[model samples]
Target: MKSKLPLFFFLILSMFFSACSVNSHIMFKTKKNEVIVDNIPISPADAYRLAPDDKIAFTVFVENGKRIIDISSGVNENSAGNQQINKTDNIQYLVRNDGQVELPLLGLVKVGGLSIIEVQEKLSQLYSANYIDPFVQVKVTNRRVIVFPGTGGDAKVIPINNNNTTLMEAIALAGGITERGKANIIKVMRQTTEGRKVYQIDLSTINGLKYADMIVQSNDYIYVEPSRQLTREILKETTPIISLISSAIVIISVILTLN
Candidate 1:
């Protein structure tokens, strides 16, 4: 019996393991396009806007290289612009009360709601008034990402160096989402002087790819939640005893079929 018992146990063990592999564990009915239902969809990029508290750096072209060279030499140090990069050839400003940033030579100008490119062009036109052929370059220095609470998010703020960050990009940076993360349900919360606005985004559909053009701004929070299917699947895999039984069943089946 002992000798035969080993064979029996082996067969049973293999079968048990195989059972687990087949339908024992991680078994749940998911809708069609399981991956889509399971994952966060990306949105399309129509336009990227700006908000307050966003820090920006601007550089005005010094045609004769005198202003550029002078500023680059560290003569007049700008607090905001100096914090931006290595030299004073640039102007740094945060979006203030009137959605404007005060510049050294250019004074205050409203920059919110305008894209970086637009800002550069506008600055060029504005600076051209003072400097000849002023070539302007503007960059968003401090980009803030928002994560919502109660969903797959935490009430936290993430800072980004580049302004061109997207929804997915933001999520990936924040340790991705938890297992219970609801990918399909993501919200990009924004605050404006008028009021607080919420841009609901679907990170799990093709349509989301269209809206994903949501360029993350400074102090904006993005909240992610878990989908039902993903939550269920996660719960199933976490069962220790069930997984053990499944493993045993698989081992038995392997032995029986091979024998």
Candidate 2:
């Protein structure tokens, strides 16, 4: 009988080469759309509102009719303003589920749906009710954005130090997206007063620069969708195992024939 070894080897080689060629074609076809990315105009980010589990710190100042630049001179009359709390002292207040934050003397104050500036104003008004004048400056301590790089990778929570973190910076921090990740189809999900919003970004063309400039917000989800060729690549990865199994079977058959 004609040897089956040659035919078996030929089939394996052909399948491998065919898979490689198809994968290459898919890569080119999918990337062609990416290069044609059009500019997407995005509006400015709305003021970030307070949410549960957010840590906020505020510094309260009580004006003492001072006119000096330095306000740390033992609360003197010449000082700009007296520090209600210690300069180094800061209360890391956590927003509760009830949309309220406990303060030293203000008790449970509703802070949900309020921006940092709004909270500062509200606290100033609250403290003014008791004291002469309360100057409050509030800021969020922990701000972060979540990133999902796709390709079966785990999600990553990246901290936003500047609050103005761009799309590219966020992806870079998450290890710059996987090879199977389609950058042009990236999605940024945000929670707004109207409801949840999703923004699509394309990074392959210069026109995508505007979208990339969109500032990242806390609790935002950045997802990089995997390429359509993912299935082909996965199937290609299994080819080696199939080839090994077939080679082993061929060797065993030859040994039996010789015996």
Best lDDT goes to which candidate?
2
lDDT of 1 by residue, 1-259 (tens): 7756875675566655544554222222343432232233233232345567777776554563234422234343233444434553244578886788877666788887887788888887886766666666677776666664334324466777665677667777776766656667666655555454555556566866765655675666676644446434444544565566569779988999999
Per-residue lDDT tens digits for candidate 2, residues 1-259, read 3687886787667666656654443211224433323443354358899999999876656673322112222342334334544452354889999899998767999999998889988987987875567677678888899888755555689998886788888888988888878777887777888786666677768977777777788888888877767457746765776787789889999999999
Off by over 4 Å in 1: 1-46, 64-85, 89-91, 149-153, 189-220, 226-259
lDDT of 1 at 118: 85
Per TM-score, the best of the predicted structures is 2
Error of 2 at 16 (Å): 18
